[model samples]
Target: MITHPKPQELTEAVARWIEEIRPSLDPRNAFLARVAANALAAVTRELTMGEQAQAAAVERLEALLGHGGTYAALNWELCEELRAGQMDTATPGLLMALRANVLDQLAIDQPTYRHEAS
Candidate 1:
């Protein structure tokens, strides 16, 4: 049996290739290559961490909302509730859940980013 590269591996390889070639590129192309590499790195992170992050988000949302749901459904419901003033910073567990969800997403999207809380 043959094994294929995982999606994360493929993204990492491409990102590495972009970095290897970036120094040889013209300034504009180098900048573009950097952007591409950054995007690929984000993709790799998402492929590796997205499921766990999503599951955790769902769990947090479920506990906060006191119900079970798919992430999208729960996320939408959360947004609706917030918009309608049904939930807010005053809501128990709301701020903590939102903070956790944002931090998890930042781990995938911008691992190097430093926030005030960090």
Candidate 2:
């Protein structure tokens, strides 16, 4: 089971990764450096809130599907699509992992937050 990451942990990890990558940057590449840092920060933010966001997504999907099922029963392609957000700049591998964790949790909890269809 993947426990949710604390916001502070995500921030600190991202900061450390940035610092580790900083020394490789040239003065002429500062713009690129900032962009990379920003991307990392965005990923970190997503990680911190990933569980809640994914739970909400699942709820939305259940409503859309008009039925309930284990996360295992969800369309794998749907899960994959949500895992890979349409961002151009950075690889969202970590975000995908987070999404997977949330799905696993949802499977265990058998969460049902969908509205009844009229």
Candidate 3:
């Protein structure tokens, strides 16, 4: 039996390829290649970390929204609540949950991003 490359593995490979050749390209092309590599890395992170991040987000949404459902559904409800002024920092766990969810997304989208806590 043969094992196929995992989605994350493919993304990582592509990212590595881009990084390896980025320096040999023209200045503009090198910049683009770096951007492409960053995108591929984010894709890899999503494949590797999205599930756990989503589950944690779902849990936070459930507690904050007071109900359970699919990640999309719960997230929508949470957004609506926040927009309707039903949730705020005064709401217990709201700030922490939001911060964690955002941080998780940043972990995938921009691992080098820095966050300063208030």
Q: Give the count of colliding residue pairs in each prediction.
A: 0, 0, 0
- Give the Cα error of residue 96 in candidate 3, in Å: 1.1
Q: lDDT per residue, candidate 3, 4-112, as tens digits?
A: 8888888889899888888799999999999899899889999889999999989888888888899999888888888999887798988888988998888989988
TM-score of 3: 0.90
In model 3, residue pairs whose N, Cα or C atoms come closer than 3 Å (at least 3 residues apart or on different chains), thus clashing, are: none
lDDT of 2 by residue, 1-118 (tens): 3447666466667777776787788875766776666666655656556567666656655554457765446556445655676322243353454455555444434344343421
Flag regions of model 3 displaced more than 4 Å: 1-3
Comparing 1 with 2 on lDDT, the higher-scoring candidate is 1
lDDT of 3: 0.87
RMSD of each: 1.7, 13.7, 2.1
Ranked by lDDT, the better of candidates 1 and 3 is 1
Stretches of candidate 2 off by over 4 Å are 1-28, 70-118
In angstroms, how far off is 49's CA in candidate 2?
A: 0.5
The list of candidate 1 runs beyond 4 A from truth reads: 1-3
lDDT: which candidate is best? 1
lDDT of 2 at 16: 75
